[model samples]
Target chain A: MNKHKITGFQYFTVFFFLLNSFIPFLGFHKITMISNQDALFSIIIGSILMIGFTFLIKRLYFYLPNKTLFEKIKFLFPKGFFFILGILFLLSSCILLFVTQEFTSFIHFYLLPEVHQFLITLPFLLLIFYFLRKEQEVIFRTSEICFYFYILFFIISMFGILPQSNFLKIKPLFSTSISSILRSSLYFFLSFPLPLFLLLYFPKNSLKRKEGGQKTWIKSILFSGIFLFVTLFLILSSLGVQLTNLYKNPLMVTYQKISFLNILERVEATLSFSYVLLYFFPMVLLIYLLKELILYAFSLSPNYEDLVLLLLLIGNLLGNQFFSFHTNFYFSISIFLAVFLIFLSFYSFLKKE
Target chain B: MKKTKLLFIFTLLLLFTGCSSYTELNKLGIVSLLGIDYKDEEYHLYINVVEGEQDDGSLQKEYITYDATGESIDEALHFLYLKSNKKIYLSHMDVLVLSEDVINSKLQEIINYLLNHPEIRNNFELVELSSPMNILFEEKIDSKEISDLIQMNQEYMGTSFSVTFEHFLEDILIDKNSYLPLISFDKNLEINGISLLKNLKILDTLSTEETVLFNLLQNNINQAIYKNTTIVKNETNIEIKKNQITFHLKTEINKNSNKFKENLQKDLRKILIYYQDQDYDLLKLKYKMKQNHLSSLEDSNVLFPKTSLKFDIKISYTNSYLERRISK
Candidate 1:
């Protein structure tokens, strides 16, 4: 009885928003800041795979009609299956913590490096927590408010990054194999828009089988592909493949190199702030997923999203010291495990279907 | 439940207040620009302290130079702090200026200090002050803030490059060598510098031209206006065309093991030449002449134009459109 209509532009904008989650966090899109990792090459190819896999995932979901992907896992596998998957998702949250910390540290160093780093992150985390405590309507409204600025940023990032790009270095594009690209795509998918799909908590029935519903997924993926290309191209052109590899933070160097005249330089603040607004959407989604997982596991449907925020506050503090980013991408969940997750989706859905 | 939640909120507020505010923005005294020079076995610290300078609205910042000596930069800074009216914080410090004495005598200590500071953001513009450190502080750059103008040099114009604090970390941490954009002030008090640092260690500065060449070779060409690109056809007037490169890398053949030996080298060379379209005189021929080490070729042909040169040259009217295409 209701339609949430999103245009091609909205679809494209959402893709940028999805990638934006990766951008603001310091190490998530580390390819742009430092291109040395074997994982860096994946940005280009991974983007393509993410697009391809989205379609396949959707088709697979159709076959297991009645259940959400997570539920299918609980039905199909033994008792501990969903719990293990929940832990994997928790690891993803840890990686996100590293990324957010890295980014905030970067912003503090660039914009107000003299201020205690804790001061910088404190404001951000507090703001994020305050929103997390609120209702979904407020969060969605906030995303709507921020999305306008995100579009403006995407346009500016393209222009700002374009002139500085060196097309020549785009050579040897396939320096990394197709496998590397797929791995990078997995990195994007594990923590991003896919995880955000846990927002299916509404009383409304299944996502419509209509074309528009399918477009939501397809359009977002396409938008991400274009974003990935631009980011890779910008980093490659600005830092050069060699030097880009050397710097731990390549985007910082790229921004340093960007000068309109001479007066308007050292804009790391503008970049970091813009990204904060953008990353908030996914931050909302992150908390939302945590809430859904706990609720679905116990079947306590009494609206505990706010309570989830409180848990995150404690978890967020403990998580600060839980893991170091050195292990971020070096350790990936295995292929067999990934397949098991896919299987869980099928079984969880079978009973419901 | 409401009473318990209120108590928890009150406790959190107490905990926050109990902890020290990490670093105070103004009281900590953000060192927006830093100048270090070795003077008479003593180290001098010149701080472009960014603050509301005077009652006058015209000048917004007061750049102060503090001179002190010790076994370490921190010690010297401590001595300077005792003399100064405010605290000296180097976290927001953007431009690190090394006087010729410090840079020449070896910048190992200064570089080490910067590397260790947690607050310094690594990618900062390492500059060389032409007129002694004191003179640099004296020059009134027309701007609201001294730091503001310093950024203008790098941000608005391709004139000066900044080696950010983070960039310094990258270069210093790298295995091989690192390069940084150098900053220099003219007699008229204008500042400029773009040079490379090899492995985060060096006093050697590349001229602006050499920096351009290095950028081109590395393919970091954001914008380039070659002074005079002279085609060596007849050594007359040379019309400049687009110059670009594509890279081809081998699978790191180990020479010690000597697996393919001759065949690999030959195969790799063929790939490189083929990828670049070596038949083109501008691309391969120029590189060849350089390889043969022609002394005459070193001469600037485009500027003097009348020098007789015997070399095959080609030019095609590829529109200079990198910037144009990006804009559209």
Candidate 2:
């Protein structure tokens, strides 16, 4: 077995990489679905729910050290049930593939309307392939380096859009029904890092201490909590609810609102290019996790991981052609996977006790 | 090592090779101001551009206007692009001018086209002209100059506030209505007043005097000097025969401050009464009422002319002039 030990800093950096991957498109739209007034409230509730899931995943890690969730599933389930576990893992990977497809389609239509979808996704798949070839530490290092660029661009774009926010646009609190707010929270839970347990394959030896994983989890929640809340607030205040829905990518629209002296225009193109910086490592990491999970599921040799990587790359390239993003389909798949993982974790703990 | 270098070079090349249909700057016809007019059952688009050239080692700017007619504003813009020297770029467009006819009838169509166009910016100021197409080729005054004139006119003169396309969209979305500053060009261009819009149709056009009162009623007086000769506080009344009254000016009477407040209230009420018959609430008081959750003005209810709305002007005056007089 290969050792994939990473220090606390690298772990936290990769955690942020995971957290921000959901942000570029999914998280922004989900909050707006709740309504403009309730977007802020939904974000707080969503953060708490995600944090609780992270803590649960951390507790699971403690229950079975140095083991992936799939390995725990095999131990908890009866003999020959590993095949069922493998199918579940494959379905989870498909969800991640669906996300990459959505991201690819967004870039294809919104960013490069003239470019073909295949051409737009090619570079992303290639980058992921390269990362898959490298050691897991390489991804952690890349994420650490990319984190600086993310924060810098975040600050720059926030400053540019600071003055454009009209707080009056956010309607009074509780304007939306409780059911709608809860539904938005559920959509948020399914879309964001709550479902990121698919990639919770960190080796126990990688942690410097027993509690290192939980610390990273808390730090990521704190950092990403502030980041998401501020971003949602800025979007709601700047575009309002109706106009926010009017644009497919409200972040780019928010970037377009930035007028430096009102002459240096089209800053959205330059600023939003930085989103590639934020998303590239996370994209590669998702693909890498998928590769590892597939190899482990089929009980293949580590050398055959490259073959899985190629297959997944080809899968992503053709994924959007075959499948389209439906909110109901995505929400159902996410809820099923989330419940399955939770049940597996609970069963494992009871069996051990 | 050789393979690594080759891969690195290939990746670097891919990064620089952006996927865009590249067009040279010279091949692009940059639209500085866009004018839309509806006449004869057709939409007309006027592209106002400042075509500058480096002739004899000096920069020379020439104003050129292009006109295209179509069934709709979008089609008309495409037609205008087809007849242009280069591909029309609307990113640099700072001003949008609509004919009164176009605004009165086709405002929604124009707004939808502008919003849907990823190229057209939201910060561009919108103004309605009586002759929108003629202003395109009006000579000497380029688009940038006209935009600056309107912006300055709003900032200092205080007749009407400049409404950006973004703010106009926001106002429409929030209040279900909005207002745009109106400009008229006879010999020279001047801001005539503001046009009140109720869901893209022009409800009414307020004249310059009415716009001034509108600005005062809204309390958006950035720095406009309003001159009126009357003072009616609680105890005293002084009526001066002056036409220009600046609100920021210090009235030198602690005792007569109430009287001044009364006079200002009386004048504001008089202006409100004058506009009451029009059924247009320029102050957006109903919106305020909705915000406070007052059930009198329901969210679905449109304020009528006979709603009997009252204006309680809270005059906050830090009277240093009166304080100094008392010290003396």
Candidate 3:
């Protein structure tokens, strides 16, 4: 096995954690608002759509097993087009800075109310900078280590939150119009599997064993989809549709209700910290992707990689100070990236390069 | 050179640690209970702060009541901060008391404030008081005693139910009405019954007996003693038909099952009729209808009063230790 390549399980952990982190912050409230009690159905349909999309991407991966999506785009598209693609990747990476700002705002509002936003953002960005300086395999290995704790905390939290869940609140399902449910499902698709386009940046050769990697990817999607479905179900049932729509972070609010045998209470802050940990994985990955794009786009030597990363972190910190991105902004950008990925995959397949 | 760089990095890490936001424990006036009242176009705030350590090593936990008034809750809280020597910490608060005037006029503001406040958790119990400051002043009741009283009454007598902030908000949002356990002071703090609220105002108050039936209908009772009978279990099921809603209450009692069943059915019907006359969805019948997808009627509020309500009660006698032996 190649030392630099990651194991299929590590890849699974990376995608699983990435898929799970995005929903509670971005997709959950919007979907619940649109479909109401039928949000669970939206997740079900959305997962199937996501699985189908993953299969198509898997086929595309098999067609060009040795090259990353960027290399393949460069191989097929014109030189100018590849530069445009590089710029798009750069823009996408920059858009992810809003997530850093959001993370800061969430911590400032919920955990450390008295702490300055810069205090939170500075250390957070520094941590990301340190992680980005490491090899890509290190990030995957870190995700593997964190995935166990994520699952353990999730199971422990469920033990406390499940008893409070009232299934009656999920009643009258399918009462929402089909169009509404479909629209919500589209939002889920945009929020979840669409972002998995980032994973395609790694070539098939980047995995230790590419044969089983597709199965791992599909399994991870299924697992993360089930986790999100259960979470949305619990939020709706425990909070009801009206309350679910009322709060910005309904899942965190639901976390406040967790009490294990009435002995352990107020573990929301701890659970939310775990959520912040999950957010770190994607941030590091985005910065790494940005570095790669900057190097490839400018045809720069490898020595400037660290300098490019430093510039990206500073740029993100400055960008966060000026702009505030909401769910619509994320949805629009995600849709754009998903469409771009789909277009690239089909063009590569049709060109047979 | 590398060691120097590492030392500098560690120093930067020390700077990032939450020293800026840190406050010593002795500097915090831990608020255990908060009360709000509206009078003279101002908000009256009362907070019970837990302070003072014991002579022994163990904490003594003495309670101090602080009162302040302002045009808004935040301003009143600011005034409260000025009076208290330590920083007012509200995360540890166990209960919040709202006066009748505050509930009548400033309930929306109160809800918004609680919902938006970073320190205030929705897990704290919310209670209604006629004169919250007067009761806090005269009774000297802390949050623990008040929460315990409500919990005990809810579990045993079923004449009162504990309503947390989350539960209250969910009820209002889902059912368009909610209820709070009404607390009063007469020589000592006592739970009177419950105050019904709708459209951000107190509609009416339920008596102790009526509250028992209310808890029964809502399936909130764990174990209640009613009319010398120990109600071990209660399961309420609602069936909605075309123009009538039916309640099937299955109950288990330790003794006097037959007589208690008759009184319970009659009392439950009477309470339902009284609330129906006022067009109040006391039992959340409309919410249940909507949940069951049977809310076809355009104006459930207008037709609910005229709609027929039927009660089907099933009672089972649970044998005591001696009775079980005798039967065997």
Candidate 4:
């Protein structure tokens, strides 16, 4: 409970949680629903929905003031129901962990090919371990430290890409069909439910300054939503709609083109750094969820070593299958994630006893 | 207090480790543009190196030429890379200048090298020069201010086709067709406009007049010359504007032969009729007469420029036999 209660500024890294959903999907998902331009329109709708969903979650703390979405649902559901839902959520978090590791490795190959897998994996494992032992506030502050660099990079990338931003490629506007974009948006909304799942573990201190929490949460979500939309837009513009559809990883392809004046080249390194920051926090969040789920399932008495065992095993299992067949994993995981999200959404809203 | 030391050590370690991870400039030679030609039954790879400037402005270009015998373009490049001490960095390259000889003899090889090279970008300009490749950079050709003028003349005036590497690749790979700009350097090495490409290979290329006719088939011409539109006392120049190119098409099926005859004769007649019927030449002359008030050339304003656009018809036949000739 002491660890659960400690929330800090870095806790906002959960915003990046949603971004991971799409990033991994790009590398592995073979069933590209749309071309790059339409895919972008899909991503924009996703980012916007995510932004609104965060706002809705924040509004729940004040506007729907009686109980948290999960708590309200839990109170209504039978005891057995919560257990099944918890198990489902646990399974989803494990997959999230797998995807996070895979995407991080993808970045490693392009950005720092020289870096060994153990070295990159080691820091992340430590980050998860550090957050697992610390109180929520410490995790939040650590996330806050990481978040500042994340933001600094985000701002720098924005400015850096401006000159390269070919506006001509953005036109002819109102081109792609609206129905296609809405369907793509549903895919966007699928990844969004992760941060909403975190509301269950929020501390009492976080709830006290409800309005302040609302503002901070909303701003971060909006910023990240904009980040995702811009990322999609940049991918679409740099690699036209046709080629974007053909390529599996549009972001990597686009960033490979970040040459300014031929002197300051290779922004892929910068992008890789930024990408790790995005996945690292979400991954830690997933690890935290795993610890909580395991501790509850076995009644393992909140021991850190218990998690170390489970995670080391899980991370290795994930790391082993990381590059095996990305497309296959993506399809299986996306469908599973969709079903899990629908289950959670129904469970959260239905348990209002 | 302990965290401060921990943070310092981490930062110091990053700095130390970062040194080894960096991609060294000395080991990488920056390729600015590439040209591939065929000679002696081998692939000739030309890489234009910008060999970046030092702290001082004392920087000079270092051009590297790599040639090898290979079954494929990538094999040739790998061979070139193997022979060199430094890695060839190609992402910086902007212009891909193809020689006429290579474009004619081995276009497929040149295209494969450009399209497949991971270091090469799609947005780079694809220029074809008639003058030998070495003469392209003879003078420091930097007319940065008049970029629009240079592009229009190069791309539109049909001295060459303005094709980006990406567009060229995209058209050739996907659409199965592409056109590129043609270049010809004068005695002073001044590069001129483009020529068209029919597939991955050059088509029957267009001269200035044929280029006009070929380009007219596709509408979107901002300027054109109406050659011999007017035969006046001083022989005035005709600058064109507000032009439209509409085809008067008639497709007649010749049942006897079971073939389709496209009578482009209607379109030709329409064009000739329009030229002969319009007396805009006389109207322009009247207007100029009024503006000048018949005051000779001395009193004209610098800004007010005018030219008479007219038509002249000469009916003569070279192929007609005297025995078969009729009075006109």
Docking class of 1: incorrect
Provide the RMSD of all predictions against the true structure, rounded to 1 decimal. 12.6, 6.0, 3.0, 14.7
TM-score of each: 0.62, 0.84, 0.92, 0.62
For residues A1-353, could you state the per-residue lDDT of candidate 1 as single tens digits? Answer: 12233233433344456555555442344553222333445554555665565544453445444554456555455577577657757754765566556655666555555556555555555566666555544555555567777667656666676776767555434444456556565665544433324332221124333422345655665666566556656776665555665555566556655555566765655755565665555555555556656767767754665676677755765566555565344235323334544554345455544
Model 4, span B132-244: residue lDDT tens: 65554443332221233336653444222355666566455433445555655555533343355544556534555444333433322334432422111111122332121
Top-DockQ structure, candidate number: 3
Candidate with the larger TM-score of 2 and 3: 3
Residue-wise C-alpha lDDT for candidate 1, range B1-328, written one tens digit per residue:
8578656655654554414445454455666667788877778776766665455546465555556676668888888788777777765676777776776565777766775565565545666665667666666332233345445643433344555554455344432244555555554545444543443335355455444333333334344333333111111122222232223221221122333324423433343344234222212223223223331223322212232222122222233457459868
Where does model 2 exceed 4 Å of error?
A: A1-4, A55-59, A78-97, A105-114, A166-171, A177-180, A193-195, A239-242, A259-266, B1-16, B54-58, B138-141, B225-267, B270-281, B293-328
Q: What is the lDDT of residue A219 in candidate 3?
A: 91
- State what share of the real interface contacts each candidate retains: 0.03, 0.21, 0.74, 0.05
Task: For each candidate, report its DockQ versus the true two-chain complex.
Answer: 0.08, 0.25, 0.67, 0.06
Displacement of residue B126 (Cα, Å) in model 1 is 4.1
Q: Lowest lDDT 10-mer window, candidate 3 chain A?
A: A209-218
lDDT winner between 2 and 3, please give it. Answer: 3
Instruction: Supply candidate 4's per-residue lDDT for A40.
Output: 53
Q: List per-prediction Cα lDDT, in the order shown.
A: 0.51, 0.67, 0.81, 0.51
- How high is each candidate's interface RMSD, in Å? 8.0, 3.5, 1.3, 13.7
Ranking of candidates on TM-score, top first? 3, 2, 4, 1
Error of 2 at A313 (Å): 2.0
Displacement of the residue B290 alpha carbon in candidate 1, Å: 14
Candidate 4, residues A97-143, lDDT tens digits: the string is: 56556754664555544576555555555545545556545656666
Candidate 3 has an lDDT of 0.81
